[model samples]
Target chain A: MNSSLVFLIVFGVVILAVILIYNGIISRANAAQRAWANVITQERQKNKIIPHLQTITDQYQQFESGVQEKIAALRSALGGLSSEKMDTAKLAEVESATRNLVQGMHIAVENYPELKANELFGKLMREIAEQQENIGAAIRIFNQNVEAFNNGIEMFPHSLVNSLLNKKSTLHTFNDSEAEAGFDYKPNF
Target chain B: MDKASPSSENKQLATFLQSLRTQIYHAKTREDLRHVLHTVRSFGRPLCYNNTSYWLGFSMGILLGLLAILYAYWYPSSVSAPWLIGAGGLTSVIFAVLIYMRRSKVSDLSDALFKQDVYLDNNWQSVPYHGKKLAAQLSRQFSEFKRGNHSREIEWLVKGTYQGTDHQFDYHAYHFHYVDQRQVTSTIRDSKGNVRVTTRTVYDHFHRYGLYLPFRFARNIAITNSWFGGFFSSSYKPASVEFNRKFKVSASDELSAAKFLKPAVVVEIEDLGKALSGLNLEFNAASELCISFEQNICQWQRQHGLDEPDAFLQEIEGDQKLATLQKTLERIHTLMRHSDNNF
Candidate 1:
């Protein structure tokens, strides 16, 4: 009976440890998903300001169809934004496109000196900058979560728990080749 | 030239430094410590009376400088214009020379600091130090310095090991230049004008200093700072009303940063951040922590006669440099103790 009791106690400790480790992995994975969601939220925030920006652009901008095309592309990308939905390559394309569109809009505005000094345009730009910053911050957060989750799954002891969960690594990275190839932006008068 | 035997002075210096190292950390053996301190000096500067001469010279220089300024102001018409300017320039030059000469003398406290660092370095070498450029890794991932010019300088370095990892902490000053680089095309193209499109890269630099801890991760991890975060900053919003809102951590995933920023890591990082006095720990930069100090690390100051052999011994009780070093080491230890948990 004493031997059986010892075996039971040992079994109980092992079970408790397994529960703790499994819980830790699930918690981290959930966090990664949440951060990815936040990235989407921030990107959408930036996207919402684009129409406001376009209203101003339509009033002042002349012969800057390049900007409109870029804006349309960015708007299209934002339409499909969702939590943990875009793979690494798609994410890279979206990020690059977003930056280019924002910059192109600013360049197009430069062609119109009056718009450059317009108070409404200035306010919209500030709002857009804030939104873009929020998106940048969210991406960093998302990347951090993905990395930590992967680490948790990859590191020993934790790796054992991760294997039990049957989870694989999901990298959040900038696709340099794709980003460079897709990005062909130039400002001309 | 002498291989087997050393001068008695060198031997004594080595022995003293070795003893000091053993007494403090006991991380190295006597034989090993001795070997490590070979030809190292106990005092980088000889202790001496910080006499009234330095003060007298400084005062004389200041008085002369003032007199020149006063003459230029009050007696512009009293003398010939050239002579007036000449007298003023002469005094100013003398004072400038004196100031230059006075600045380079190593202080008593600096000597002590050097000796202390030497011993610490010996122990660190045994523990095996680490040094790395952490931001270099992020440069590839982001376009932070792509369109413009950027430079990074390691201003100061401190190193130690914790949680079975070697880490070298650095105080870095970074300068970034944003320029409008555009291709300019000229209509006047000649045989010599093969370079039709000229690219202009005009750069102006803005610098900021931060404490950088670069360490290799056993596995992949990413952590970022939240929009409303930071322990002691003006733009602070206590999201959820918690006093422990020093940092808002976000992992690559939902709960990754929350789990990684464990109570142990948070408490330790908080203590370290607070002890840093002013630097705000930058959590969003990368997984490797970077605390933006916004100023230079404590530069070795002019000793203020604190290390003078002839100064009042009682006044020497507060060795400011040594105290600063002690505080810095303690904070660094606290920071590294829980660093491995994050990534």
Candidate 2:
């Protein structure tokens, strides 16, 4: 075999490998954006369930749903949706309401063995706990995907096409403040 | 948002300005600021309110000038000319000067009060409409509205803020005198029974006054009061019987506009217009809601052929001015009340 032929084949194979690597990175970046959106959806669902759980807790008369302004915050957050268009203000409202409500539920049910023992109530609480756990899992998955996507955009070979894939929404959703330290900071009421 | 108070003599507004484009004067506790506007208007009788006297003065000047021209051209040379043309010239100058003097007083007074009552900077006292940035933003939102910046004289631009229990929003009262050149085509007939067509460019000055506000929405929308307005905009019908009757709201999509103009906000807007007499509000929406009405808020002495206007008056009752001001403030508050809430 000619030495030049071998070199050409090796060069062609290397180029093919680079093209596949670029495509893989692009796919990963897009997948990360979707995962981030899903995490936010989970947050919204958690917000939706919070009030119902608090109402149930209130019926038991065993714990206070530590929400200082439950009705107003919840009303503003829920009513503020204009057909899936939520401004940052509305998102903040929903986040604050949900955070407060969840915190209150946990506080009120701490020592209430009877309330916790109620089979149906126990199931509801467990469901809420599971959802809370899923929120963490979702956040972890989002952060992991974001880490991979960040590499795609920052790495030399893939950086060339990264601008095309850089969505403005990605920057907003992957706010370092929100995703850092195990998602410790939720919106404060 | 209580950044400045009316009484705090040194309420320098450089910091309160959003840019050179928008100036805001936040009254400390939100007292009735309309009294200030009323007191300013009533400071002196409206420059040309007495139509008969004004026209008579102007007509007399014209008569004098016409008489002088007649004396110069049509006077029989057989008789000694009394130089009546000079007299006519004097009359025109006197009439002009008199109008100039009164207008100057009125203009000056308005300036002084506009600065104080409206809580504006001294720099804004004579500002011509130079909201190029705002105009650009507006043009992007409403493709029909152009910023012919070549001949724009902005008289007053005030954005007032009212801090509510929860959030804060803004209402802008901005007015400008703009010049637009229009090509006019006309037909001419010659003595030889030949017809000719001619076109000439004419400059027209239009005063645009609007109470503009920004309302947050899910997306862009355009709403107007007239079909001509729809000529430049995609017509939007929310299909709510009351909304269609009261306003012509448009958007790129029907559903977005319909969803944005919630019945409750529409009611508030209607009530606001009713409260402010002579304010016929037209609606448009983008990232924010724009409640606009065409009513000149700027008072220019030169535009009125006056020298200076007054803001303080001694004899005339300010009741009418006060009433109008009250209504204006009420309307501003009503339309702008929820803007801070970002709904």
Candidate 3:
């Protein structure tokens, strides 16, 4: 084989390899960005539940105390929300408080047996449950993104780029107990 | 005419005087005085019954008579048989009388307890009654004794004292002492402190069980130290028995993956594409080493005319630096698990 022909073939192959690597990197970076956005979306959905919860709970003044206290605490923690540095521990506390408040409300409804059968309260509870599920889904997506980002920075070839860019992967996680238990709120009279 | 008029007037006057004297005499008898006095007393004075003294005297008399009979029976020969028998009959009569008296007294007290309108006095405390039945009845009627709430509060007060005979959880003892707003202090101590006290509210206590019996059982268990004995006795088994039992091992391929791979590798390569993107020349050095090692394996396979060259290539490619890191992590995990199991 001629030297010029060999050089041409080798050069083409290298170009194709570089393009493939670049495309893979770009697609991964985009996915990571999308995942971060999802985390924010979930957090917003969680926040939205607070007001509706408050409104529904307004009818039940006695039951509102615990729920209100938890909501206030959660709001304070989430005030300066940043997806880049979400505190896993704080999130866990918020999640737990939310669950306990839900339980408290459920118990309170037992006093007024008719309240459990109230259309508004029932709808509100269902909505809150759905919102919680959505938040969980969002958190999972965010964690998935974080895992991808961390992998890219730590994997071969991409690790070199990650180091050069000085980019660190954020940890996105939910409370293990909460995730396992799945929003337990049992009512007893 | 004058003589005849004077005789009739004189005869009429005598008859009138005789009738007035007879009526006056008839009104002053013993029965009439007695009736008048009774009426006066009934209207003027309150009916007085010394309940405490009455009961005490009656009970003491019965006790003394019983003692006398017992003494006579012990020294039968010292006393005449007829005399002893007579005394015994007399004692029995007294005893029967005392019992009747006691029952009537109790009935009177019960009526009083029921009829008396208890007002929340300035002290905000209930007046202590002499009779137990009276006190209990008064407490029920006057105290704000709602079934659920009051029972719950009382349960909280009595939780560790009552243990049910069934279940291991019942065999725990608890002690609780608290002073209420009335300054009435109560202390419940379970000498056998085997009970596990829980923070479950009174509502929960009842809701968990259908009736008060189970609740009482749970409470007694909480209060008693004997609960542990009961708990263990109900399900007594030797350590050897537990050890002898074979654990069924269910084969799970997914679970096996968790056992083989290091946690770090699974965690790091969870997003393989992103990890590859993050890697640059420096990070790729590890991958290059892996690739070179794989290439050598491939070359060796080619020279040897190995039928499964691709399989060997896959094995080499899959066993990256991440896998090595995972293996190290796995070793640490295994060591931790072993320590935990030993503990």
Candidate 4:
């Protein structure tokens, strides 16, 4: 082929490659954003479950003190507490306390058949379960995005741009507690 | 001759006829004749109590009307102007007195709803309650009721309970005053666990300006969280230094550390500060710096009349006071530089 014709062909190939890479990056970024949004939505939904659970427990006021203390602790931890300060030990403690509270409620329900049958109680349980699932899924998606983003930052050429934008590697992988807990188990009491 | 033979019987019959005629005449005059006519018209329906209240009310109403008319005429408008003025004044005075009495009654209802009498150390002090719930159910119900669904509010309050032995949880009762659709009057508990009273007057402060106050507030809260987290958790510690050196270091590196951290550390600090401040101000303005920050924001918003977006933006942009923020940041940067040089 003539020199001019060869140059045109190579330039066209390079443009196509760039377009493909751009699309891939855009998709990953969008997936990450969607994942974070899901996590936030799930968190809000989970927060909403507290009131309903409280109502069911109200009839058993004998358990209020213990439940109240647990609730107050959870509120302090989740409401505005920084994740940075939340070491593995503290996070585990919080998670365990929450699990225990749920277990306590399950035990309480076993004694009160009427509570278990209540429409509000049933609905609340379902919602809480769903929220937990959603949050887990969101976390997974977020981790995937974080991995991709971090990889992009570390990779040749892209790393330079990432540095200029001040983007750093984010900790999006599952924590040890999350890995140990596996999927959240539904309490049958 | 026949009449003479039964004179006693004829005389008794004549007397009975006269008595019957007199009874009919008296019935017609008394309007009892209408009752007799209606008896045939209805055939056999008995008089009912349905109209009893109506009839009694009608009579009483007529009497009142007559009395009112009589009073008005008794002191006729044609009478001297002085007399008319005196009567008018007296009537107004009476009306005012009645209104004052009614107002007190309404205030009592408001007080019961919004005031809490918390007993601590053998003394009862009045505190404001904003219907906050430790339980999730009650809080949702409170939020719903505040949104105007009163039925849910009552159901939640009646059914909601905290976990514990059912020792009468009277001390935990909260009160609320709906100052407006957005604002609330409440007493919050401070860091020292003392009650701090506050009136939160939520306006459309951001809606008009196309700003999201809640989001902004949340961002600030997040920043504070990260700051505290990093500060407390850091394994790295600097050697003991003079007060000046410590202050200088804090002003520079400590502040800049947040800026460089991944995921934007400053936002976390700002968010944490705003949230804590909001809570602190609501609970106790006397002890916490958050309350002072809130007060400053409130004053600035008020002075700038933030309801008008254009005016507010202009005020903030043109404000000389905002320069103080930049100056402070610069000073902190300078201190950090000095500390870095020393180290």
Writing each residue's lDDT as its tens digit, candidate 4 over B1-343 gives 4643233553443453344334333442223333323332342321111233334444554555455556667766644544544555555555555445534432432222111111111122333322333223432322211222121111111111112221111122122222223667898998999998899756431100000111111111111211212212222111111111211112123433332221211222233244333211111112111111221211111232212324323432342222322232232232222222110
Local accuracy of candidate 1 as per-residue lDDT tens digits, B1-343: 6553324544454455445444434424334333323312335533332334445655665566566667668777665545645655566566556545434332423344343444353232322222224334434432232223344333234443323223445333233223343444445466887545455544454333443455333112222222223222223211111113444433334444443342334444555555443334444324444544334443443333323433322222233343434455455554454334211
Off by more than 4 A, model 1: A1-3, A84-86, A166-189, B1-300, B303-343
Model 2 TM-score on a 0 to 1 scale = 0.39
Model 4 DockQ class: incorrect
lDDT tens digits by residue: candidate 4, A21-45 = 5554555555555445544444445
How does chain A of every candidate compare to the true chain A by TM-score?
0.82, 0.59, 0.70, 0.63
Per-residue lDDT of B149-255 in model 3, one digit per residue for the tens?
Answer: 22222211111111122121111111111122222334455778655443432222221111011111011111111111121111211111111121111112333
Scored by lDDT, model 4 comes in at 0.37
* Native contacts kept (model 2): 0.00
Model 3 chain B — which ten-residue stretch has the worst lDDT? B289-298
Look at candidate 2 and tell me the lDDT of residue B81.
36
C-alpha RMSD by candidate, in order: 30.6, 21.7, 36.9, 27.6
Q: Give the poorly placed runs of model 3, Cα more than 4 Å off.
A: A84-90, A160-189, B1-343
lDDT per residue as tens, model 2, B241-285? 333455566566666554544333455544554543233333344
DockQ values of all predictions: 0.01, 0.01, 0.02, 0.02
C-alpha TM-score for every candidate: 0.39, 0.39, 0.31, 0.28
